[model samples]
Target: MTDDTTIEIEEVGGHRVDADRLRDLLTENARIREIFADSDVAGLRVLGPQVPVRDQDGPPFTATVVDATGNVAATVRGDLDRPDAFEVASTAVVPNPTHEELRGALEVLHADERYAPFAGRDDVIVYQPMPPTSDVEQDDGTVVRRITLGIFDPDGSPVHRFVAVDLRDRLVDWDLHGVEHLDDHDCEDHLPVGVGGLPGGDTGLGQVRVRVVKGGQELWSFTVVRPRDSAPTHLGKGSGVELRQVRYRGRLVLWQAHVPILNVLYDDGVTYRDWQNSETQFQAVGSDPVGPGWRVCSGPPATILESGTDVGNFQGVAFWYDDGELQIVSEMQAGWYRYISEWRLRDDGTIQPRFGFAGTRNPRTCMRHQHHVYWRLDFDIEGAGRDIIEQRGLILPGQPVWHRIVRETKRIRSPFAREWRVLDADSGRGYRITPGAADSSADAYGVADLWFLRYRGTELDDGVGVVGGPPSATQVKLDQYLTGESIDRTDVVVWYAGHFLHDEEHPSPHQGHVVGPELRPVRW
Candidate 1:
């Protein structure tokens, strides 16, 4: 040994040294060499004892040291491999890769440092896999069943169960669709909630801090500041209308509605009334004033019409001078109503129904089609003088169809466009008429086929919009119709069976005379 304190030579100048002293010198040299190698750049030289072999080599000594720049200076050992170890020690201080880059490369493996001790002594290094726990339970006591993340181990078993975390609540929950895992920092305090740690002892699994917001029975809930600690702000505003559930991008939004009218377009001043409210308030509706839409009408005790009651009380009447006689046409529960009586025009020009049925069925009431009775008058009437009645035919429960038949008049218009003749004419060629466009002279003088189809429509009180869809004719514009202005549209709905679309060539249906809101079908 070179140092006097480490010298154990009993006989100097070719004498044996003490084994303990030699061992002590070698250990000191190794420590000094390692420190110097870590700090050096250019190099320095170190001297130490080398392992002795029985059949040995030329020299039996080792030396390793480094320069100031952390570069290996030189190594003089009997074995050449000793220099390589010295070089590795010197080059160990290379620049460290960024944490982000390292994490990217190792995230899949869950290669995160559980314990990184001071450098040089790495015996206590520990690594943990990502997503450290599974079988997480929710506040409602339901176990999370799905996860969108995967787990991995470092040494032995590489697979482990992980639970999805609720970001809002900061709680771990299982999800089958995705594997859920945590960042290294979040796993610090998190403990394994399930079984199976290491075999010998409890694995030093850490715990994670999670502030979970408990769930409630409400459809929608969010955090809100209350007088005390923060509380949940529920979306359901007192539950006027209870819905099983609703979603917006898979998130529930609960709201309440109590008023009958729901204003959809406050900017445009448009609103919608609930169907229930409309039904309750207006049990009976009548022809649209301002042209041809149905108006809520209440008369004859405005309740739902009973089986044998008069719907006539719900409608209006139109009068005309017919062959020096006064005539009236209207509708009631019994169907259509028509009244005719001799007229003596008073000098004062006052008009009245003289000795006529309060309400009577109009010309066409029942039709024998395929030997089946189809109620076609269950519809609404509209326009100047209400045209044909339109209705949704639901006689067959399984299938709903639409039907419109023109009401034949005692005096019907001629197809030739020349004149009006008796409906029971020489040929009874029941002509079709369409509400003429106000500006078109040709149509103003006579009706057209296309206009007839457009003018009549059958709609039912379906929950949404109209059951049979919008009327055939372009619906009377809201602005024009509401303002009492005439638009090109002139479709009317009325209550009459088979009077909606009549074929003069086909035999007429059972026509009837005016009685009272009751139909007394008469074969014409």
Candidate 2:
């Protein structure tokens, strides 16, 4: 080991030179070394320290280094703040390989005999950092990172193979389909085994697990079950929507396409709901082996005609119209019931949440029932503190329907029957929850539109029924949070309930029906 106190300087070309010391200094500082290496520079030569005595607590020292051609390369600055610190800072251009270069490299890799089967086939190749796992242990202090190139067939079949690279060692590993482990020491041997699919049958969907690793430690992991149909649902070919984690307006915005809770009450005194909790009865999206019934829909974006003015379109914009709608559909009761849940993200930062039931009615004739769908929105608005809820109601005068927006806002200290808004004072951003389209008849509680309550971590007992349990249960945990606790400038949760009544007179459409609320942003 080189002593930190020793300073070596070699006079080269009549100029004091210390190339080895400069390289050692650059390598000791991780950030500066990364910049130097990434810049594709050949080598660096230290000219000399700015000060004669090499003061330990003096200002930063500047040294000039020459590139491979012996020409002046860069002027590096080193801060001698600590006796053992050799921190270097420099301005160097680290040019990343272009997409064409990456594609060319993939083409060359596909030419290998191991990847020949996937060559010349229309495929989707995704590159991502492999997470940390026990399979690859890094004991040498060399930061071991892996990048995975997942290759999928043209029809969006399962990932054909995972081509990985050990960045630190510059080694390559490939797991090809139908091939056993090529090497006994392969990382595949130590990879974590994920749940294949539904316990009993194939769901036509496949699972892909990726781990995000940093410094040989797993930081995060994600598992994505391949959809039966890869195309967007709005195209009408499928109903599976890909919910992406996005950062909107400097805030992390994530969405879940399906909410497991769906309650169906029949007029014949039977209720069906707890499918999510039932191990034997729970069916995943593509569980139906024969002609997978579940589908996701990315509905065509429609123009928002609010207040008779054509606001910017919802979903995403194109040339003429916008594209919207994120939907998922799954069947239960052996195709007797098809449940469709949809979430539409608008360009205006509003979310339109809706779900409905369709498919053939049950064998029981004259089946009149109501479907209540509840959503659990765990909002961490502006970092999740000091949030308040307010209810707004329209006060209509006698025979006078105010054309203008006539609504009252009140702090919700307890469970309230009105439209609500969750506001964050720090960010000045708020969300208003309103009911979707509903029938003229009033609900069982007379307030079918929405409900407001504080957040109790354990509100849902076992995910048996909706958040509020059955109507008969006295302690409806959903309303239990509304114990008159002041929700003013406090962390709270607002639960919105929406229902659709299916009667013998008018049945659900052959396709299905959609109903839910529009979550609009207030002063965001």
Candidate 3:
């Protein structure tokens, strides 16, 4: 709740599938083991396949397995084309540097005498450069894995330079940008609200049950699945906040709603997502280079006071009421930015959903970019029946025009057509969505703002690849899901994108940057 009254928060034991055990099988598979070539399998990440039904025991799932430390990835399935009943994968995919692998990159630099000024410092921040660049790498016999790492040194350290070092040490390239590295905490007090990966660790299996009540009446309820980091939405299935059995007052609204992917496009044409290089701890990597092409701090700079808040809940659900609404919130860190998934419901059945974009520390913090969050809203209306969707157009004459979405397709918001509604055709009860003021239109990389499609088990996400893959992977590619399906009178899922701009110039950054929509009750 944005503003709230008396609220209560608690956690209940819940398990949809044995994700951990399933991952174990994938890791132990003979064929999969060979792919890694016995690299120290130091850490592994698997994004579970799309599991449409939140409840129902052990549905067969195919998970995308990532061995970041080992530099390879694959897909694992319970049932495959083979009779052995399962398949490890068809081919091995290269993944980005792991949290540990990033640390190893730091060591690579320390060994060189030129970088001796900051030798043996564990606080160095390291991460892949953002977008098109992060994805750009030479696939030659000598694979080039470009990396950036630097930290603020008050004594004016030599941290403002771009260095490309071949692991073999034969090719160490440097391009310096002389930005002063002041050892100060000037920007520490401006830490943004809602840091991600709150109460971090083993996210794939974490789920929190929440119930919102006000003045003795149940208003909203659901389960929050803190999903694992994915290679990209396309390769994996489960990630982002999954709200199950969402209810308003005593009636059903959305069966499920969650973020399939949040794409950020910078002025430099670098695209980032919620699943790429996600933060698993207190600090996440920041964007844009601070000085030159270097600046390292694994989490936020040590100077930032509030970036290190203890993430509570070793295992369950938690909640609390605030101001005038009942707010159920969760956080996740993708590199330097924190994604805050908040669902707020007031006593009057008014719903205000928001996704926050907050930063830690980095040179790119001042760079102009756009944060677009895609939410898969699976609407049940009164019950999972043939429902209808509609959009409101500009006020023509004295009346605002309303057009019902007749087919499965993607949509872009405009001043003329700015709102939409989904309803139970028979009963005619539904909700209206008013876009956030900051929610911008489609950008060069962010194709469109919304996709109103008929419900399909296989269409959970646009499946845009994000792990620094091919040039094609960087695109939202939601158009693939538009292969015409009727939505005239059927269960529908509305994918809404909240596009917020992060500019260091205009619009006071100190005020805060949060973007989302307000779903007001249309008619009960």
Cα lDDT of all candidates, in order? Answer: 0.21, 0.37, 0.56
lDDT of 2 by residue, 1-524 (tens): 11111111111111222446655656555655564553334344343333211134244444444332212134455454442565444432111112332344354455557666655564343331111111233475223333334443435333234555443344457752222222221111111111121122234332222222333443222222222221111111112222222223445332122342445555644444422210112222212211222222123222111111112111111111123222222222211243444455554567665554543211222456676665555454665456766555555556332121212111222223345666775776777766654522235532333334444433322123111123443111344344666555655544455566776567655223567667777676
Give the best candidate by TM-score. Answer: 3
A best-first ranking of the candidates according to their lDDT comes to 3, 2, 1
Question: Which of 1 and 3 is the better model by lDDT?
Answer: 3
The runs of at least 3 residues in candidate 1 whose Cα sits more than 4 Å from the true structure, single-residue gaps closed, are 1-428, 437-524
Q: Could you arrange the candidates by TM-score from highest to lowest?
A: 3, 2, 1
User: RMSD of each candidate?
Assistant: 43.8, 23.5, 8.3
Model 3 global lDDT (CA atoms, 0 to 1) = 0.56
lDDT of 1 by residue, 322-423 (tens): 232222222211112111211112112222211111121111112211110001111111112222322232356665343343532111222322121111
> Stretches of candidate 2 above 4 Å error?
1-247, 252-260, 276-335, 395-418, 439-442, 445-449, 460-477, 508-512
| TM-score of each model, in listed order | 0.13, 0.41, 0.74
